[model samples]
Target: MSMRVAVVTGAARGIGLAVAQRLASVGMKVVMADLRDAAQAASMVNRDLCAGVDADVSDEASVQQLVAGVVARYGRLDVLVNNAGISPKHGGRKARVEDTALPEWQSVLDINLTGTFLMCRAALPHMRAAGWGRIVNLSSQAGRSRSAVTGAHYAASKAGILGFSRILAEEVGGDGITVNCVAPGRIATAMAAAVPETVNQEIAARIPLARLGTAAEVADAVSFLVSEQAAYLTGVTLDVNGGYFMA
Candidate 1:
């Protein structure tokens, strides 16, 4: 059998890189996709299983080409980890709704929410044709509640992702595809660096784990959802927040 092909967006660094590395290590043909820096990531990952693409997930044209190029090269796509996202600009968080600019809010939703939507829509044709697929979205704890530091737009986008994943799962379960999400909390990444250190440290002290979550930890959760072991699971949001929020 041919190796399974997987694409993970925003995989140039941090959680995205960790997930891409893990998937590649497991013998999957991992395409590490990102817009900010693609050549750097392609050069860094293991040569055998990882490849990189400078893809802007927010743009439909870019996403179309991204999926097509990957499929053209590998012949199939089995797993998709939508890890590309932003805080305020991409809806991970936003300032006060009234104060936030419409363009900024739209930009956030475009990248964080619309980006995921487009990837899923584009990948579905191939997945449905093959009769098997795995989609793992990177949501956030803020989606469940309010962000301690992130903006409202970020929270709203993530919340939207949760509902979208559930519905997609229900729609495709009969076709041998699973749609799931991972909601991370306080992971130590450049994205999280936006907040002040003093605030970050204070927030870290509140988690039951009493420490920041690692990118690798979140990757593990994502890997699980996309693997055959999770065959029976779908439409669920697995929280990887170090007990920041229960239930």
Candidate 2:
């Protein structure tokens, strides 16, 4: 069989980088896509097993170009890891809803929610053509409940992803494609750095694990979800929160 082609957005660093590395390590030809140029980050991994693309997931035209470039080179897409997102901070904590600006809210929604939809739309047709595909959307613990570390817009975007994944899973299961969401808690990454140190410490202390989860742990879950081992699972939210929240 030919090697699988996996596309992971926001893959220059953090959870996105970790997921790209994990998938590549497993023999998939991984494509690392990010708003920033990813040539350097992609070089850190096996250059032969990985490639990079500059993409702004929030823009429809950019997203289309991203998928087209990947298909033009690899001819097929088997897995999509939608990890591009932002959690904005003001004064080292989430901006209160009343204080949140309209632009901030829209930017978060554009990248976190609409971006996922666009990437899925662009990649799903290829997967359906091949008769198999895996889509893992990065959600958050905030989406499941309330979060002290992120803004309302961040939480709302993630919650929107949950709903979108479920509906898409229902629509595409017959085509041999699976859509799922990975809701991570306070994973130690640049994105999580937006939270105040005190807030992170306090939240960590409350968790049974008593520490922040690492990006690699979340990546491991994502790897499984996209692997053949998880072929039967769809429309489920996998929590990688280290006991911070349970459902």
Best by lDDT: 2
| Alpha carbon lDDT of each predicted model | 0.89, 0.94
Error of 2 at 209 (Å): 1.0
Question: Per-residue lDDT of 1-247 in model 1, one digit per residue for the tens?
Answer: 7799999999999899999988987889898899867657867888778888899989999999999999999899999999888875334333777888888888888989999999999999999999999999999999987676877888889999999999999999999999999999999999887767787799899999999999999999998999889999999899999999977
Q: What TM-score number comes out for model 1?
A: 0.96
Q: Model 2 Cα RMSD, Å?
A: 0.8
Task: Please name the candidate that would achieve the greatest TM-score relative to the true structure.
Answer: 2
Off by over 4 Å in 2: none
Error of 1 at 163 (Å): 0.6
TM-score of each: 0.96, 0.98
- In angstroms, the error of model 2 at 144 is 0.4
Point out where model 1 deviates above 4 Å.
Answer: 89-94
Give the per-residue lDDT digits (tens) of candidate 2, residues 132-239.
999999999999988877899999999999999999999999999999999999888987777667877888899899999999999999999999899999999999
Q: What pairs collide in candidate 2?
A: none
RMSD of each: 2.1, 0.8
lDDT of 1 at 115: 97
